[model samples]
Target chain A: MNERPIHVVGGGIAGLVAAITAAEGGAPVVLHEGGARLGGRAVGSAERPWVNLGPHVVFTDGALVRWLRQRRIDVPLCGPMVRGVRMLDDRGARFPFRQGLQLLPTILRREAPVDETFRAWAENTFGDASADLLCRLGGLITYHHDPGALSARFMWDRYRRTALSPDRVRWVAGGWVSLVDALAERARTLGVRIELDDRLTPESLPDAPTVVATKLSGAGRLLERDLSWPGARTALLDVATTADPGWPAVIADVRSDLATCCMIERETAADPAALGEEGGHLIQAQLGVAPGVGVAEGVSRIEDGLDVGFPGWREAVGWRRAQIVVDGTGAVDPPGTTWRDRPSVEQGDDVFLAGDAVAAPGFLSEVSVNSAVQAGRLALDARRRRAFAPGWPTAELTPERRLAVLAAVLPSAELTTTTVPGADEVAPVDETGPGYRIERRAGVTRATAATAGKGGVRVTRVVASALPGVARAAVERLPVWRRPFRR
Target chain B: MENQVRAAQGGDPFAMDALLTELAPWVGRLCSSIALDKGDDAMQETLISVLKNLPTLREPAAFRGWVRRIAVREALRAATGDRAIAVAEMPEVAVAPDFETAVDIRDTLTKLPPSRRAVLVLRYLEDLSEHEVAELLGTPEGTVKSGLHRARESFREHWREA
Candidate 1:
């Protein structure tokens, strides 16, 4: 068995999934978290009992639940939310049954096109009112201010997922805190070494198969690559009330075509012990706000909806909190791009990306799970290559061998500005092994020195400095001129 | 998958890139197995051909078959164009002391002519029927059958000599 560790950065769902998957595949795993805690967005704060940054629901049919169930990771879950679903329309009345029936026919309609906008396609397929309602209701899943402008394929897939089988939606009983705890425990059981509060930069990264599961922007900074994708911005409101008023379980306010719908879920109604032994209703409402819309303005709109839905809710409120989360939800594909068009997972440089925004396909947090699994599998393959080859000195890599090299090099992007760490930056190699130094300049890989001769080859000097084009072309396109120095 | 094909055909560079990524490993494997040392050249040529003719492909479902034919043809061309046919021709055949050691399949493969290697790879490695191999190679089934028979006999003869 290869004991070489696959390092994972970030402690989010993606990071945890990657670590566990790689570790279970028989690779020694070391997970690093910048923060002191394990869960990133999944668990808000250790002090807060079960409250999260927002109300998160994991569907039984989705990838997240399937992955968890397969691994036997026990997490208490709430119902499929069948009863008390009050959908308020723009007329300030309940979701008209006739209009709702129109959407059901769309369930049997032809698949959506990838290039067209969802709004255009939905309006053409269904009527204007149905389209508007579909896009607004999309806020419940996307948390995007304008879901209609997104790709038809993106919106349609999620729409079918939710609308077709509404019963698939399940909530984590005690919040994602429990799920996070379960994942951490599973990772530990698989012998994953967890490092807390250890933030790693690209240059400082160990020369090992690694997964960077941080948020897209953070990954870009770490890898010195402009890794970006579309994410959702929404206002989150957490309200705790003293009275357990008989309010609908979830109220979706699609009261205006101009504004996205506001969704409020009463947690206490689902789980009586949601707050504590002495149960108090914890209602979490989220409203997608357009650009320049302040959290206060979004909160105000949501409160207005709450006034219509939950009567006397303002008077019953014990405490309430409102804030805006920018680009917090998974990812939103624009008019033309699919999930494949997002930032790719296989970031050449022994560093794979595993997150919601990366290339792997699924709904919401499911994307993170899918991407992490893929990144883990890729990291395992890389680990296998290194373990088998044992520092091969061949400069002319076969197309097959180049894949090994693909998972090996952390290209020289900004390492000159980055003060170098210890010699074991990539991975701890034997001092006498054939370890060739990496040097890059202008989208080409160069090996400056090889510290090997009689005993064996050791990479002597690694100079990691190159132009910004490294992200776009350096790794994927080496221009056939990149041949590392022969030992 | 069809969506990717359609997008690539419609001149989406990103879609083409994705398609290349999806097909690279399989193409590399086929090219390396048949073309040997010139596998790199064969892979590059095959991908170039695949991407260039992507627009001409009418049915996206037949993509794998189409790519397989191209890969086989490119690999055979690369192998036959090589100047190193006499690499081991002049050497005296030597038997190894470890009698139970199986012949290194890749090494054994390198000894055959390019066409013969293609026949063997298509027949055994790809698990294609003799008729399928002949059709893929644009040759008669009789020629495929005879080529396969002769190839097996030659392998046995080599083993006996060793």
Candidate 2:
């Protein structure tokens, strides 16, 4: 029993994080992913470029970011750039959307009854006209199609997390797939075995403490029980545009539903090679549809909404792929099922739970990674308690072991930059060629490469003062003959 | 099916898998109806418990009944733990006609207390007689009858108000 590996079901972010953390903590682990790939719902393809199944952005100070940093995995993150988000009326007039605490004053001035539906609360507080506007905006923010079904208290809790957290939204450099790949690689390096396309059954379960990290519905099915948690259904459209939309991401009111469009090309680290020779911008449009809406109609409505938001969208679109996602996230907190009703991490003595569904601190993906960390720690603690008596010395992770883990995990990117030690100013090694500007300012060296006719920007910043050896190794690995960077 | 159960009890992995696959949906529905929102958790626990105790099941032919019994126990435990409600102290619920028209059966079931809901679900949804529901719930026949009556009355009252 002590030697049995910890079984982590699902290959999503939660499962990956749990497996990695548990393995790192000296627990043998195995991750089983039902899908062909490890990323589960958050995977991206070559055809989609930087856009994931839906528009996914990581908060800079999120638990996932901290976890990645602890593993020494370098995931380049660009800004939470203040972009234009407008609420469009039926007549096409655009009004800037207010989010987070920006609408707190308006909320405080209104009187809303406790334990009411969000729609009812909004209507009671802000009247019918304002309720419609607020509900649509809330739908956009919460990713719920029907705000009427959502709880006001739950909405308030979610709003506080979004508005109050110090963390700012930032795009992962190479889409979510890159992060997923890195996590999978890290799990493998830590001796955590991953079995893809293998579904777990009661009899087939590994002889170990198991953490069920799949979506709520999937977890329910595996356990052979019906889970009554309500979930939001969504349809996602990935569009490759010939021209930039000039905004990193935007949430717009589409009369019937709320539609969110993310300019993946602008947000992510520009990789011309990954984007291909055509060099079109990748835009992801996600529309939250009502539960009963047909998939075909939902897709059409989302496509039409995108067209309305960005006129001539059909002509500008290069490649388009549409998919309908059911139970994409975890169990949503409907009117009766608020945060308190969410399942706990400790499902049983040996069986643990993690994912967006489990009650963890924070919102959405933050809840997922946080719950995974807790679950991993719990499993590790259980393992240690079983392995040794009280006061017994446990194995600790050394710096060398940490490096070994990182080296095996970090994926090689096209652009590489290295830092120099004890140097106030460091420039690119002159091999970057013409049009590649290496600017040194305030103890930082920025190397930028761009090309004419190709509409993209690739910038790599090397923190020369820190991790000089790593930077130097990266620079040495570059080819001797460099392609002339076009300006 | 009996042969498969016997083989599963004898530690044949394939036999166990086949048996569980056949029983999973039935157990899931039973647990879901009883435990409501926490049906999945209850179902998983019930399946695990059943698997652990499979060898001890004296009569292999009684596998369905054995699994059903375990599911009911697990569902009751899940629904009542820390959030238990007394049979007599059921809260007065307002039933809107629109709610009946708009919401699904699961939504209506969720509004009732877990204990009464368990009784109602077992009696009506599972089509179990009062005595069987009583036996499954480990309560007296009178309690089961009274609980079912109260649950139905409450549901009907909500409809009446609507």
Candidate 3:
């Protein structure tokens, strides 16, 4: 049947790129997505203030930029240089990091009100309080963990720049999704077929070639039969407002290590006009929201569907907002984890893998998209040269066993299991059945802020990686105010 | 907000305006989204990059892809540049805007990494083919094609969540 048009599984960025390249290379491509759409984690959330993963940044050296330009993803060049950074600490101390040495003198001369001993030195341009705050926020925002535990170099990588110029920072005139939409149109024009809600399995693909590109957990699920890798979790804060907050377009990771409840409500009084001159768009790290009685309570941290919970989150912002907190560790893959660890592209192994999990030095990075694209193209090239084998993996441990191992390895409190479509049976980690199931009810919180200047909001859901138990516990622990807003 | 491509390709000032009108908002949104709290810095730099690089664009029709690439590059440069300065006491700019809900498009694009998302948008929404995208990007057609394929898959997955 014409070789089934080179089946591609997992329609994340990497998979999409693979499909495009295959079609361009004169191979008809059919892409399978287990979900209802494409773009994977790059888009959508059930809550608000809606935020994206990684703010979805791209670099000049990456392949995606070149591809977009080739296809005319028309957008202007906002420069890549940031003018400055502003950081706030647990005590509400504010600091700024700006371009050029002149600003250094100004920053160093300042003193904070919280502590008389605190004096800003010329070298302390981002501010000590904020820097301390950044340590925690940087951990959560950049690595989905505490910043103190991460590499300082990696922590600094997010803010380090080559120039002190004012215009190095840039943006797209539209939101991140606009660019995604534009790409979809381009794919359609190239006669590339896209399917949503089409999850994939090994058998779903043809023998020609394939690429699997998603986050670590997703990638692991796809490759459970082939290999094992570490997984990660993420939390995102989405906020919507009526006025421009007059803040910088980008800022450093300044996680306020305040009380969890205080942290949740910290931004409630934020003046949108003061955050940025432009309205309704922002990307920043280390944000906090205070807890309110009603719609303002935070979601819980779930563990094994029981109520092992965190304190109820408070609401500090009046805008409509939600936070997504994932629990997967997403630890860095063991060193030397690469295509070499598996079958060689030149050795004719047909099964291919791609994602941030494969390419990143840590849990995630701006380079993940590049890794996906690179892996897909490499697979295509191998297939074209007849260098791939159609054989998939069957090993000492079956999918069910592997899942069992996974449950055992992970913190038991946060996981539950069920049988997927083809599994022999559905079992929990504690169960002795041949087949098992594991599931975590991600914690999602929706809050409404009624501050002075912002719009009165409806429901918002915060997403987090927690056991279902933790989620339930957090929900019950939620202040009485949020009981009516349950989704 | 100038049509650097048309100008470089021998068009008049009017072309620059058309280009600006068509592309500026999209670029602005992109910068804000990624730059987040620091979007203005990124947006301003991106605009300047666009203005400065306009003269180098060789094709008027391929302007969209080229400009979008430049924006992403500019944003990255900005983020990285800020980190290099790393003074502990600097006042970070306040938070920027959240552009997610402001503009509406297909959810599939979200699956793409930032880079691929740019390509998908340029290729599809802007109606530029692979070669045109490649020309604007100064890369090979093959690279563009490969990126498009992966980006499509990403879109399919993300669209489901939306």
Whole-model lDDT values for every prediction: 0.72, 0.60, 0.40
What tens digits encode model 3's per-residue C-alpha lDDT throughout B25-50?
45654553443334455655655555
Off by over 4 Å in 2: A45-50, A70-72, A91-104, A107-114, A126-128, A163-167, A245-251, A254-278, A385-487, B1-162
TM-score of chain A of 1: 0.78
lDDT of 3: 0.40
Chain A TM-scores, per candidate, are 0.78, 0.71, 0.53
Tens-place lDDT per residue, model 1, B90-134, is 232243222233355456666656676777777755668998988
User: Worst lDDT window (10 residues) for model 1 chain A?
Assistant: A425-434
- Per-residue error for A406 in candidate 2, Å, reads 27
Please name the candidate that would achieve the greatest TM-score relative to the true structure: 1
TM-score of each: 0.62, 0.55, 0.44
Which structure among the candidates has the greatest lDDT?
1
Ten residues in a row with the worst lDDT in model 2 chain A? A425-434
DockQ of each: 0.02, 0.01, 0.01
Clashing pairs in model 1, backbone N/Cα/C closer than 3 A: A206-A426, A207-A425, A207-A426, A207-A427, A433-A457, A452-A457
| Candidate 3 docking classification | incorrect
- lDDT by residue for model 1 (A173-244), tens: 887888999999999988999999999987788766889999999999988979999888899998889886
Higher-TM-score candidate of 2 and 3: 2
